[model samples]
Target: MNESRVVGQVRIVGAGLLGASIGLRLRAAGVDVIVDDSSPSNLNLAIDYGAGRAARDTDDPALIVVAVPPDVTAAVVATELTAYPDALVTDVASVKVAPLAELRAAGADTLRYIGSHPLAGRERGGAISARADLFIGRPWVVTPHDDIPTAQISIIEDLVLDLGAVPVIMSAEQHDSSVALVSHVPQVVSTLLAKQLLRSTEAAISLAGQGLRDTTRIASSDPELWVQILGANSADVVPILRDFRDDLDGLLTALAAPAVPGARRAVAEVLADGNAGVARIPGKHGQDRRFSQIVVMVDDRAGELARLLTEIGGIGVNMEDLRLEHSPGAQVGLAEISVLPEVEDRLIADLEAGGWKIAGAWR
Candidate 1:
């Protein structure tokens, strides 16, 4: 393990969506990166998308990130370690415990190995979805074992930080358990809810609104990939699913007898609990709370967005994320801007005073 914080070279294996994105980020930050993928199509796509140059067998990379699926992550890491004996190795697989145990059982080199998971992704997959800034402001967990060298740990930390992510250090077991609650369990819940909607009548789904769409967004994720992630982390996931079932059973019982005081209280308490739980989730850029969403009606001309942005700048309230929804046959577009919750009213007042139409405002 080397203890130097400076990262020199990076090699990413797989050239899938995450791999390509990582390579692009490293290269954009002026770091040398080489990418390898077994699939020629994926490699070509990644290179065409400006990920990195195709990795050569002779190039001894300082850090290697394996972005393959969870099922194959262990074997791939083992082969990379053997191929590049001096390179520090890590993986972006969702589950860490199974692969770490596999590496031990297979007697692979553990000194250079660090387990990592970037808490970010889109519903879209493949190199086509690759973006250099995809990981910006996201949490990247680094799970290191006792046998790993300090140098290797530092290398992983620097690489993750350089990629514009916040590096969180934890043990492999702890990382897996934590994600099971936040990432894995929520994915399962979304899928289960989506499945219920799938079996419903067409009229039922047609009546669904934005709330349903928001809750079921993860259902659009790749089912095959999730199968591997959920299966690999089953040990941590099963207990969560069991507890979920117990809560769900209680909710269903409340629905069965709505007039019962105890059941009604339980249902109300669950909803209140959900409100509290949502308040605890870290907001954008890991802030404790999110700003209010303010909608502004924008004209659909070429310079309309620029004009709105300039107007916003004049108002002096810090703007957050922006979303645009174009209207059919209408001259205006719905521009949703996020601002500090307290500043929302001030922003609306300023924009409205400056001749900009205020569409709506919500927290």
Candidate 2:
């Protein structure tokens, strides 16, 4: 229970999705991970799910990740560091700049601390939805200060590596700004869009398609959690929202214009530019590469996907990703599996040979 000792243990100080996932991956890698949580039920559930053993007592952990809520991040990290002085403590808080500043204000050592945010999560929360591969092929951003030890930073990078995620280095300010652009702003927009439909007619809402669903999916996220995150990072997000509002005003003005030749073309050109901007987004794993999708027909019955996955396994094709979309009127659902362009033909042939139905493959 003393500092400057018990230096080989990996401790995860939250039993939520991110913390449990980290513990699960580290435990799978033969690393001894000890878990702690304010909620004893969540802590026990995480242990039951084989994430890690419950911490018998807090001591000098070798590496500690304080994966708590954004508002509590600084206070929790500061407390953990004080109690375990020799530990290299870090936090996976979504917003970094505020927490780092708060820790500094609390006189916590910056040498053994780093701020990290793994750009991955489920629509669901809690340890029940945790998975060991949650961070696999995801982007984990690390913000290391000038005073942070090189060895400590490397250890954090190594942890990201072991979790099968790509570690991207950024400063606290840069990380906050970039996340505001990509993650934080999108959540706010999605929530706003979903709120727009809250009072819509039942018929109009029922007629909604995949575009609406996809755009507003994140709006289903925990609103309370989002409030805390957005509140903490409001400095970075407000400017982005102002720019979005300007763009939206431009679109509204363009639509209000007449259907004259130049007027229509100008609006179309702006829409085309938006399309190009979207295409620039990395399809998966931030590889900056396009993916080819193959749509396969799957029945709605249980074990149907398991059977199809078995056939896919026999094909020896590596699938980059998968998305399931049920056809409204059809008896079958479309399973769009994304794979490397070169493997599409082989995947089709193998599935056909295995007596599995093929829908269509798109490049």
Q: TM-score for every candidate vs. truth?
A: 0.90, 0.90
Q: What is the lDDT, from 0 to 100, of the residue 65 in candidate 2? A: 92
Worst 10 residues of 1 by lDDT: 1-10
User: Any idea what lDDT model 1 has?
Assistant: 0.87
Give one clash count per candidate, in the order shown: 3, 0
The residue-by-residue lDDT of candidate 1 on 1-363, one tens digit each, is 223244667888989889999988878777677888889999899989988888766787878889998899999999999998888899999999999999999999888898999999999988899988888899999998866767678788888877888999999899999999999999999988899986899877767655686789989999999999999989999999999999999999998999987988999999999989988988778989767998888888899889889988887877877876663466777888988888888889888998889888898
Q: Worst 10-residue stretch by lDDT in candidate 2?
A: 1-10
Cα RMSDs, all models: 3.4, 3.8
State the lDDT of candidate 2 residue by residue for 1-363, as single tens digits.
Answer: 012212378899999999999888888777788899999999999999988897766455789999999999999998888888888888998999999999888888877789999999988998999999999889999999977778788888988888888999999999999999999999999999999997899879877766788899999999889999999899999999999898888777778875755777778878898888888888777878877888888988889988887778777877788888774665778788999998888888878787778888887
Candidate 2, which segments miss by more than 4 Å at Cα? Answer: 1-7, 327-330, 345-361
How many angstroms is residue 90 displaced in model 2 relative to the true structure, after the best TM-score fit? 0.4
